[model samples]
Target: MSATPPPYHQTAVRPDWRDLPDGLREAVGGRLGASVVAARTATAGFTGGFAAVLTTATGARVFVKAADLARQRHLADWYARELAVLARLPADLPVPRPHWALDAAGWYAVGLDAVDGRTPRLPWDPAELDAVLAGYAGVAAALADPPAGLTALGLPRLADLARSDILWWEEVAAGREPVPPLIPPARDRLPELVALESRLPGYAAAAPGLAHGDLRVDNVLLDPAGRAWFCDWNWLCHGPAWFDLAGLLITGYADGAGLDAVFAAHPAAVDAPPDALDVTLAALAGYYLTAAGPPATADPASGAGTVGPGAGPAGGNPAGTSALLGAHRRFSGEQALRWLAARQGWH
Candidate 1:
């Protein structure tokens, strides 16, 4: 049998913008103008960084994101890289227009033209889901072969990243902290995952493509016209095309029959080669389990005793957290269990 999963603290922590460097304000004002009409917090449940909506005197609106420099430098680099990627994409693609990026002092900021839209409620209609998926697929098709000289968003390849992610889960499972029910199964599934990894390279070699590594419902923006635009390219990288489709299927769509319909709709399009599906499923499992498990005090960005069980003033929304955990349980629990059972040589 697999070892007991590690104990974890699941909490939401909001970063204080008051401590943000003055240079960030100066940079924002300099680029957009000194007339800062209004500033307000935008979203509620992100764990990586803080976000705000800034309105200038001229009525121009921009979304500013302040990421933790001490905790994740790669994320900062991704902000810069995303700007370049947006620049490379055809102007017509349904993506936010990145205005400018600021990397001053120890903080990093990215300003993008705020799209007028909102996140649709979960259990979306069939047409809505199809539209979102189609939009994403179109974007991928457009950038089928990335332009030359474009730097990757500093994200590791899928195979390598998957392996590292598994090890991280393993470490968390073996840690002193309490492991949530969702994680033990993920830990147990490592061997088959390892076996799948060995066979992925060959399939990946067939069609090397670009993917928006994180394509959950939250990252997608639906405008008043029902158009969908993707944001948050921090985890962007080159990998199997199916990786992106799998991410959406596993996280955004429902499980069981709903999931079967999604695959049925896009026969060859969503059918990943051999173990590619497993790798993607395994990665998704690890992401939610780790994201839901707990906060690490040592992690200044997400792990500081700011959010999770027994969180302080800046902790996350309990209702939202409960909803997220519930969704993860619905779609990912079986995969997590299968992963765990595989470790024990269970058929």
Candidate 2:
């Protein structure tokens, strides 16, 4: 097995609620009432945008997350989409409940019910996986049919997403980028690999329901009782239920957890073709790699390393890079490539 890459840190830089423009803060305060006196920033996300918990003088609290479209044009769209999705999600889903939206002072912000929870422990605790999987089942059932409001949101389908993120082998083969050291096998077989990747766009299954387009470990939180609540509604979409299931399973995969065991227990896998899993994993890899910088320029051990800017004051925008963020991207991409490699035998 290849050595483990660095774990993804919750390095998202969020402004303290008070740091926001006075007008915006006043608007939020007026909406929630001026009783709010304490605000603390959370370093758990990678958005690097505006996110923090606001506590009222009376002890009421709300998790406020926002973005400055001027600096984060992409995040603005995501924030808008999140407001749309959260407003219409089924009542039974475990997402944080939205209280209000604030589009003021050159910002897009939303106040939500602050979840009292922690991220799932790494190394795939079986119990936690069980709870999250069960939550997926409920979500699948509640969303068996797309909500009337979502059908018009124009969310991308699975194949649509894959098309947006073509394989890295294609990039390297075309001289657009160099291959990373993590997947040396691809360098010599670019043609074969690229040809095989052509099948991805057509493998998208019919929309099973709503899909959490960006489901990953960091986006999920575990409550005190062990139930799971998925955060980050910015990437919600209408697609096969199994897409998010595959993502959650992939998180476990990176930790050396047995994906087969977990997949066997999910109803989403029922009657699903084996190739379905392959397609999801491939698309995920594509997404991660696309956000990363050029592949490793030298041996990682020699300290010729790259990093993602992470979610610093620059915000956790994908366009930024820090040594740590880069490793996380590479690590995630490597896991994805490994998962895909296991599915197909090379020529």
User: For each candidate, how many residue pairs have backbone atoms clashing (under 3 Å)?
Assistant: 19, 10
Give candidates' CA RMSD values in order.
Answer: 7.4, 4.4
Can you write out model 1's per-residue Cα lDDT over 1-347, one digit (the tens) per residue? 22222211222234445546777667668877766677766543434465677888888889887665776565566677777777666678898888887777677888887888766445556677777877877787765676553443344565565544422334444563344454444445555544544554455445566667666666777888888888776666666667677666544444243554464455335546555566556545544544444433253333333223223212343422223332332244344445334434555
How does model 2 score by TM-score? 0.84
Best by TM-score: 2
Give the Å shift of residue 183 in candidate 1: 9.5
- Poorest stretch of ten by lDDT in candidate 2: 308-317
Q: What is the TM-score of each candidate against the true structure?
A: 0.71, 0.84
The lDDT leader among the candidates is 2
Deviation in angstroms for 103 in model 1? Answer: 4.1
- Candidate 1 — worst ten consecutive residues by lDDT sum? 2-11
What is residue 124's positional error in candidate 2, in angstroms?
Answer: 0.8
Q: Write the per-residue lDDT of candidate 2 for residues 250-326, one digit (tens) a residue.
A: 65453456575566568877745667676666655654554565656565434343433322111232542223455
Candidate 1, position 300, lDDT: 35
